[model samples]
Target chain A: MSYSDLYRNAMEKATARDAWKAETIEKITAMQSSHKKNTSVRHICFTAFRHSMVPLASAALIALMFFYSKNDFLSPSLSDSSNNTPYVAAFSANDTASIQEQTAPIGRSRSIAIFPNIVEAPTPEQALPSDSCSLDDAVVSTEQYDQAVALLEAQLMEQSQDGTLPVVLTKSDIVAQGYFSANDTISVVFALPATSMGENLYYVYEIPLI
Target chain B: MEAILSPADAVEVYGNMVFRAAFGIVKSQQDAEDIAQDVFFSLVRTNPRFSSAEHQKAWLLRCTFNRCNSYFRSAWHRHTTSLEDYHNLPFTPEETYVLDTVAKLPVKYRQVIYLHYIEGYSTAEIAQLLHRNQNTILSQLSRARTHLKTSLKGDF
Candidate 1:
């Protein structure tokens, strides 16, 4: 026989396994019911995920930035107590009205002495002294500031017309002036409108004797 | 134009053809069968629209070519397997001798020889299928024919 005839006959004789063919048929039949197979679904999902990668990363980065900035602003000042305010720690349910009363004159009487009419308040050892409020005096830690803020926030929220805290809090609104000489206490000078609509007021809080 | 073959029909009709083409290059029954399955599965997955029965056949052949190339390039196919076991292939002694001689040829020569001699693809058609110049295929075919003639001198 010729080389061509021999090659053709041999090539034609090769056959596939019967079981494999049956398995392939079964798989193809399954495809009729599942128009979208796992492989195709994976391919589509992978392509979409690939294309949206940039936007997803960008959104994550923006969220991270917001988190860090919020933390930085709200971070308690453990390093510089002299320059920090003492009144944030002085918050008490009994002193709310007195604080509001002292603060009533802020927008009108910027030069008036603060905390004059404070009721049942302990005086600090030295007002505006070089050494200021300490956590030892306030009995509050920097980590607990969130709880403190939440309490203060809720109080302010009730007085607020819209019942929402201001989005931004600046250093000008709350300040720790000094430790008073009367009772080894520190005083916080606060001046701000209760809400955006309320009048700006001034209040001095002598850090409670606790 | 003939109706396009369904996945099952295509496998039944072209499975042997694809296997032979794949085996000509890879020279392994296992690899050839795998390549054939891949070709048919791809058809089932894509369900490609073809102009005619010849178009479908050409598409399957092209897929077989690509799949064989991929198999050859894989790390698993790095070591060459012996063809001694293949001596007992399902063919007469003379036919098996011819198949073995064809399998021993280099891949490029084997590819062109199989397409030209066994599949009856013209040199021009193979050039189009393989994206090569017609003259290159013609040259490869000539060299392959000479090598086969030299190896199986008395048979030729």
Candidate 2:
């Protein structure tokens, strides 16, 4: 027989084999009935769940917005538009008082002069006495102030004797001793106290070699 | 078109159809029955309106096939013995041996053969039910015939 015919014959035999048992059919039918019941209920439940999700999410979003707005209103320091108005009024009033005090007649308070000390110059004799006092105090004290002055003076004398304080030696001093060498730079950071509004003040300074 | 089929009528008419389709793929009567029930339950739960009786029938068959395929992939299914034993039970002696033999074939070939022959589906119908191309159904059917021929050679 040809391959096609043989194939057809095999198929026919395989299919003609048997009917399913009665007990099996009954069992399947019962299962189908129960499954139908369960699926119907499950689908209804799923639909209900889906419907509720939208309202739940909306409620959550509304609650979040309400709480956030409430928090903003409660904080006295937040500086909302309304809150800043009073602060601006108080600042302007203070500015006006300060202006009055600054422009008042000099006769009202001798301390109010802008250049109070510019007209007063110490006599040469007074300058000589103050300089001697500072020098004598430095020489006689056994404190750290005396030690620092003595060290500075010794360094200056040694520098003068070396005629330019050795170029390579100055470079080394700049790197190690942080002194007044060609390459030396000084950095200073000034940290002020925190303001009442909880912000800090910072100043950074970079001083190049002279 | 008409009001939905009552759960009772659906069970009476389509239960066997669904079961056979499930059995064709799963091989075991128990798993097939379970799949059949699940399909009917899904139908009742979804309450999807059908255009005609034919559409309902096709839907059940499709659902049954899907459930059976899911059963095959389940962890429990992998550990179970071959569903060949389902037909070997002490019921319906004449047909039992034949079914047992068919069940012994690999799942891929056996499913196409059962749908084509026992379920009386056309190649195109089987392809649609299994969500396969017509060529794939044809090839599987051809392979199944070859396997059955060798298996049933002396007995037939």
Candidate 3:
């Protein structure tokens, strides 16, 4: 017999089981179902995650902004001092010890007006009550403060040139925080020791030099 | 509206051809059946578009060759093996000897012989399907015929 003839006869005797068709169909069905289930779940999760991304990022950004404004990125020195300890502000460059000493009572007042321009140059007598002042109430005009400073300067210059205000600058503890030029005179913002000035606090004695 | 032979029908039609081709190379019915199932499973899974049924047949035959070769190269095939290639087929002595001698032929030669003689593919067509040179396939077929003729003595 020929090789093909023999191979054909042998293959006829060694037939494949008919169960293979059913088995293949079953496997294909199971795989399709599993693939569909996995894909659906993964698709839904991915969709949800993509949708929520913007809102989540916005919330995180707002939270970070809040924290950043409140604590200035959590600077070590500020965090330590802000913890009910009081707000410390540096005044005179060399008078650090006294500024720190004064800082303790300033936070307790919150209305004592740490910033010189906090008031409309209100006389220390017309100073607002400790709880009545707000940092955002109204802006203090630089011109108004300068005018009040100028008035004080003229008085000091007139009295000092005639040597009538001899005790005005008798104390060696006076320190100038800042100075500015106006009207051909230097307006010096001199901080005299409260004890030397015979006053406890809240006085702006601007002296002008001729 | 529907193809005469759907992708699923490929199994029913070409299942025996793939099985027999694998059987010729591996010389085991169980392995041949496994290789056929894998080939058809790939067909059903991919559902690849073919220009013609002959294209699909050629693709299946190519997959059969790869699957059979992979079986031989598999670590499982390497480490553990059947000591005897016992067919246990109900065949006449002559048919069995012919099959045994063909099985003993190198896989390339066996593939060429089976495709040419049994599957009725020409040398050039076999070369195209196997991705081999036509002259190389012709040489292998010639050598395979000589070996079979020697193994079967004058009977071949």
Best by lDDT: 1
Model 3 CA deviation exceeding 4 Å by range:
A16-18, A32-210, B1-4, B83-86
Tell me how far candidate 1 lies from the true structure as C-alpha RMSD in angstroms: 28.7
User: What TM-score against the true fold does each predicted structure earn?
Assistant: 0.51, 0.42, 0.50
Taking the candidates in order, what DockQ does each have? 0.19, 0.01, 0.11
- What lDDT score is found at residue A191 in candidate 3? 43
lDDT of 1 by residue, B32-135 (tens): 87777767766755567899888898888888988887777665676765454445566788877787788878888888988897789999999987888999
Q: In terms of DockQ, which candidate is stronger, 1 or 2?
A: 1
For model 3, residues B18-65, the per-residue Cα lDDT tens digits are 877887788887778778777775564344578777888898998899
- Residue by residue across A1-210, what tens digits does model 3's lDDT show? 666577667756655454665665565444434334333433443233234443443344344334323433332322332322111121222211121112112111111112221112223223322322211111122443355445554554454456643234433443334332211122234343344534322233322111
Residue pairs with backbone overlap in model 3? none
Candidate 2: which pairs clash? A32-B37, A35-B41, A36-B41, A39-B45, A40-B45
Q: Count the backbone clashes (under 3 Å) in each candidate.
A: 15, 5, 0
What Cα-based lDDT does every candidate model obtain?
0.55, 0.44, 0.53
Residue B58: error of model 3 in Å?
0.5
Model 2: chain B TM-score relative to the native chain B: 0.81
Interface C-alpha root-mean-square deviation, candidates in order: 16.6, 19.3, 20.3
- Candidate order by decreasing lDDT: 1, 3, 2
